[model samples]
Target: MSNSDDSRARDRLAVMAGIDVDNPELRRRLDAISARTAERLHQPVSLVSMVLDTAQFFPGSHGLDGWLAELHGTPGEWSFCATAVRTGRAYVVPDATIDPDQATNPLVTVDGVRSYAGVPVIVDGHVMGAHCVLGFDQHTFTPADLAELQDGAAEIGELLQSYRRGDTPA
Candidate 1:
């Protein structure tokens, strides 16, 4: 479902994710986290994305240059993170080109993101966003991969809660 049609719980979590909060240190920390996750997962991209009604904002990201990862955000329909939120679980697509569910996704067709692994970042029992890794080459995700992503998502969730609590990064 679209963020506009999302549950109040989801909306609350999004608010808790501090989408409007301007914390440069937090952004830097998140970006570093994304970089680490990408390296750990051997993926080309990793992102801490907050889903919005019309778009998804990336406070943290790796493997994306100014070519497409705009400050304003990409369209929500183009976001795989939205799928994680919709499922409220880790979503994996081994090969977007072959997966019926993801084959036609714009991110796959337009940007050539072939494989994806995303874990929902929940706050107050609602999915606010996702910690995601993307690959340009197709690679099946194993249970272990899912578990690692879950851990990363958990860390993201904790950091988000701290942000909401006004805990500044040192």
Candidate 2:
């Protein structure tokens, strides 16, 4: 499905979850939560991203520089996070070197990102984007890790509701 279609599904899910996407405080909370999740997961990079009709926006990220660059890079096809949202499921690559999908993806190779784990950031029930973690070494993700990632995604949804309630854009 297209990005907008996916986002619309997420928005509907958010509404069902009683999350208000107009709150401004949600942005701060999302940022803080992203940091905490990253630290807890012991991952080098963690992000709470929103998939727009075109680009992905990282209102919250840890262990990364340049919001517009790292979090919000090219469109969905080039973004693993976007793929998660589009698929409405978790996507993990223990080693990009061995992932066929990464063959044409420059970021995975150029940045030496050997592993990546992403859970759909579901606002309500539809996935708006994802909460993702990246590692530089070959890493293995477990059921516990996936659980934690899903929890983080839920938190992100709540934060988005808060942001919407506050009429804030992120």
Candidate 3:
């Protein structure tokens, strides 16, 4: 995509408005979305992570040992999550080992991630973070895969909106 379009796409996420991550119901909804995403993608590791100044925090995830705690303090270099936020587009990494853009990411080298696909979770034009799925084996993705991931991320945003309006996520 063009840099201009990428910038506009990223500007579309307004996660800083209307909701706070500290809300319990919001966390619950994010977790549910993460779980469902993992299952739907048939991926062993899936995560809903939000980027902070120095780290990315996983409110929800599937697979990986001690995932919640372990993934909580991931630095920027370890963050494909942050990349999604920066680019404002879904990242479909068919092979992490060969992708120069992410070849040196700590998660790619140390975390055993071969294939990574994720969509940024944006709310009210602010980026919350990303909903990501990691495949242990190298793989290819289709348009359907991107659509599904995008839909799941949108659901996360919608859930946050619902919480703000005192309604349940649909």
Best by lDDT: 1
Query: How high is each candidate's TM-score?
Result: 0.86, 0.78, 0.79
lDDT of 1 by residue, 1-170 (tens): 56675567456655765543457777778888899889888898898888876688888887886556766358888888898887787888889999887889887898788999999987666787899889999998888778878888888777776777455543
Please provide, for model 2 over 62-94, each residue's C-alpha lDDT reduced to its tens digit, 9 standing for 90 to 100: 777653445444565667787787788899989
Off by over 4 Å in 1: 1-14, 17-21, 165-170
> Can you tell me which runs of candidate 2 are displaced by over 4 Å?
1-24, 66-72, 165-170
What lDDT does each candidate get? 0.80, 0.73, 0.75
Question: Candidate 2: global Cα-lDDT?
Answer: 0.73
Q: Which candidate achieves the best TM-score against the true structure?
A: 1
Q: Give the range of the ten consecutive residues with the poorest summed lDDT in model 3.
A: 9-18
Pick out the ten consecutive residues of candidate 2 with the lowest summed lDDT: 15-24
Ranked candidates (lDDT, high to low): 1, 3, 2
Off by over 4 Å in 3: 1-18, 71-73, 164-170
The RMSD of every model to the true structure, in order and in angstroms, is 3.0, 4.5, 4.3
lDDT of 2 at 29: 75
